[model samples]
Target: MTTSKRPQNRADWQALAETLIPSLETRAFIDDAFVDAASGETLETLNPASGETLAHVASCDAADAELAVAAARAAHARGDWARLAPAKRKRVLLRLAELMEAHKDELALLDTLDMGKPVSSSLGDMAGAIGSIRHQAESIDKVYGEVAPTGDDSLGLVLREPLGVVASIVPWNFPLMMTAWKIAPALAAGNCVILKPSEKSPLSALRLAGLAKEAGLPRGVFQVLPGYGHTAGKALALSMEVDCLSFTGSTQVGKQLMQYAGQSNLKRVYLECGGKSPNIVFADCKNLDKVAKRAAAAIFHNQGEVCIAGSRLLVENSIREAFVDKVVEAAKAMQPGNPLDPESFMGAMVDETQYRRVLDYIAKGREEGAQLRAGGASLEGPGYFIPPTVFDGVTPAMTIGREEIFGPVLSVFGFDSEEEAVAMANDSDYGLAAGLWSQDIDRIMRVSRRLHSGQVFVNNWAGGDQTVPFGGVKQSGNGRDKSHHSLAEYTELKTVWMSLQG
Candidate 1:
């Protein structure tokens, strides 16, 4: 795979996309080649931006999953990857990263067409994915095993070894980025990986398979199975041959995977699941205007499909009305537009089902008596698009305030004091992420420490680099991703002690 000339602007991108859409790879990649499902069945992948069928992708099921698992098992046993030298593995992964960077434009375009996210956003996401791979590759040789403390007559060693087979099931919201987050570390640790991408956005993963092959990954070392969650996803989770299952999606599905793991081989399951994160704004915060802009982007970005989106906004009562007004204006400016257009800030929902689900939540907000402040109706068009919707005067008991809508909807609540704000933010089943804006260092530290979230941002919203660990507690699921911490999940720690008696 090599770099191709990319389009410069919206019109150019639209023209280029027309030529690329017709030739996308739509079959599963198994054992380093694209193959049809064993059942010979295919599923139609729709473009949410235009409500049109992009391609008929091979619909893999349990049988295909079995094939993938067998390949992974064989690859692990063959020792071509799992037993390879760390330096050699690092070189292969570095080459893969280079290939991904070379063909980033094509990968980004496929994600945009398949999932209805803005092309600009996909491009940025591709950069993150590529960088993650590079980071993992570079860290391969740097990870050191430990020599445990022991008496002179005894020797103790702690070793980190790769889990045999890793099945990565990623969500459509950030397909490439999330997939990279899982597979890069697993592969960097010299493990065989089988990726089951969301049926809604499988193109990027399918495209990525060929690059893996081009970068010298052994046959059967990496594969992509594209199918429904109940079929392909369940098969991977329940397979006895799989040694680890890493997933990012809804909490409900995460629980199912856990059950499957228990029923099967008790594979190591690492999940980063759903969230109804809160963004608390204190009265002592300086720069209300900056806070309002960040608040809008935190919830409204990616069309509010983000699992860590700041959907619940907690504001101090003294600035609740004024802050919401500014947020509303910012939301108004982020109207839905053609995903191919670089200028578009927001795009259509992933599909009609999610589109209607968000709409149903909006209707429930109205029925539950939350005050509607901004856009509420769905946009009249062929695509599944809903403009940013804001609901003020929301109580903690309201449906919109408590649930994860997973759309561009904001529920606002007012609190009288810092204690009340912290309480409101912690009042959720999810503890994935939270945000608070305050100038006072004492308040920022106090509130940040008390929030029941895995990651907290003060004076910003979801602003963290790849070096930071990302995960959640409670229902948001277990295990972490990113940085050296994520690498631990893909590996197992073993201690060996030897006695030296002469």
Candidate 2:
């Protein structure tokens, strides 16, 4: 008897390598069915890894946002989308998931070219995007309204309905995945959505609109407007026609969005903003080297572009030096290179502006009397890349410690006691996510409970399961993504009270 052999892990990736194309360009999907932008301008997308021009994205202005919003409102009012049954909508979402999976390689390449994340990581992001859509699709029909107990003569019912005309603004970092996170749930909830992808990385979002169309979604139900944040993003925030706004970006921009919502109309605003999250390493941590390695990866992943990066390293004073040494070694091992290369770990920053911003922050750290352990300047190339940097003696007051650099820069600080560590962790205005590395269950429970963050990791850095809610506290913005809580955000409740007349 003979049996077929299963492919090894190396062979699996090699199979995917056959599908990878070096030059794949997905043109921006404009809603030709709707009116064009009044400005009649275009924005050029650049490959941050090589500084080469990629594609020309539509430069949508206020008028363009208005057109998109009007189309969404019309789609909702006409019941072209919002009237669909939850199960039918779920089917459409499932089709979308299938389409995304079919074109995973193309989408991954587009993401790498536009945003400068490693191809390996970009592929993972594409997979996660598909998973998010599929997860939301499966859960859409499971959402049910409550039926209140009432007298025999009458019935009391509660209805959960979609918030129509949703405006989704996604950040450049994790562009494809974040867009799917917002649009999938919004559409599954029966809302017509207008998506605004960040100008820096708009390719995947545009391609997603095309995929949604292919999935049997009606026109005007899903639209993509790629432009500057000030114009397109602000328009969505302030538009009275838009029912609610979902945004993911910086804390400063989140505040501006809140102001816009208040100034124009009191639209519900949901944001996932910046984080200066702490990665605490206690003396009793099992596998100290492994913890340190993960800690380095958490901060340096995507060139530290993630909103939940463990940028602030808080270690017990007893083991601070050793942990720092390990972390520095791990950081040194990651070499920045072309995002399309499978071997590269670190990639370029989003653009010149972000590159300069990270450099300036590093300079500020040095001026504030912090010791620069490694890498402090930009790489010499056509692309916008920064080396992995680490700063020692980082006080809470220093700019590098407080601000979101959004680059491959780690700031290390030491604390003597558990109380001090917790205090230092909670010192930041942003409370997105925090991590604790320790073997003691008591320490994990205590520190996890004390930390002022939305998500906490025990003996790990970044691990997101579909079942758990992900978001932030305080200035990190309100509302949750993933889990059942995200489903609640897309819906509105209506209660019907009945009185029995005997």
lDDT for every model? Answer: 0.93, 0.85
Encode model 2's per-residue lDDT on 37-139: one tens digit a residue: 5777888888887777877767888888888888788888888778888788889999999988877866876788788888888888988889889988999
Residue 145, model 1: lDDT of: 94
Kindly report which residue stretches of model 1 are placed more than 4 angstroms away from their true locations once superposed: 1-4
TM-score for each predicted model, relative to the true structure: 0.99, 0.94
Q: Over the stretch 160-203, how does candidate 1's per-residue lDDT look in tens digits?
A: 99989999999999999999999999999989999999999999
TM-score of 1: 0.99
Q: What's every prediction's RMSD, in angstroms?
A: 1.0, 4.1
C-alpha displacement of 149 in model 2, angstroms?
Answer: 3.4
- Whole-model alpha-carbon lDDT for candidate 1: 0.93
